[model samples]
Target: MALHPTLQAVTERIVARSQPSRAAYLAHLDAARVQGVQRTALSCTNLAHGFAAFPANDKLKLREQKKPSIAIISSYNDMLSAHQPFERFPQIIKDAVRQVDAVAQFAGGVPAMCDGVT
Candidate 1:
């Protein structure tokens, strides 16, 4: 199917506006890949701080860099029925990641307020 002209125009405009920043981001990733850099390269203090709350086994895996760690920032609140279902998302994501030998952490929660209440 052909894209609507309005949608295509908007997409082209967005792409033109983002060209510089996108190119810079790609360049940075290329440089990091060429350097063979990984999060394991962080200083001991920084790494320890990053994994301070992780379980011992997960911490060890992080140090070994054998698996990538994914951070899930949830914005779930029981008071809001719409958002309540998301409370279990972190564990679900963690289980899925574990199946692939990767690790998932509930990094933290973002503050959420109901617009109706405010």
Candidate 2:
């Protein structure tokens, strides 16, 4: 079997359009990679400051990096219907991650704007 002509053309166009961005993103990731555990690269004081707000159990889980930690960054705001559903996502994510023996924190929220309303 083969892809339809229209589908193949659309796929080619998307690949061409994304090529530059994909290359730049790969380069950025390579630049960010470094030897050893990335989190341990931070100074103890800095690491403590980062972990200060976490609960005791989470602090212990994170200290040894025994369990994977997930940061749930969201763009949730009640003002936008699209963003509103994200409000419940963190707890849902946390519960799911916990079941997998991983930890998830609602790290932070970013500003969300609905251009149509704005």
Name the candidate that leads on TM-score: 2
Candidate 1 per-residue lDDT, tens place, 16-91, comes to 9999999999999889667652886688898888889878877787878767788899667677888877878888
lDDT of 1: 0.81
**Candidate 2 displacement at residue 14 in angstroms:** 3.4
What ranges in model 2 sit over 4 Å off? 1-37, 115-118
Measured by lDDT, the strongest candidate is: 1
Q: Residue 19 in candidate 1 has what lDDT? A: 100
- What residue runs in model 1 are displaced by over 4 Å at the alpha carbon? 1-37, 113-118
Alpha carbon lDDT at 101, candidate 2: 73
TM-score to true structure, per model: 0.60, 0.61
> How displaced is residue 98 in candidate 2, in Å?
1.7
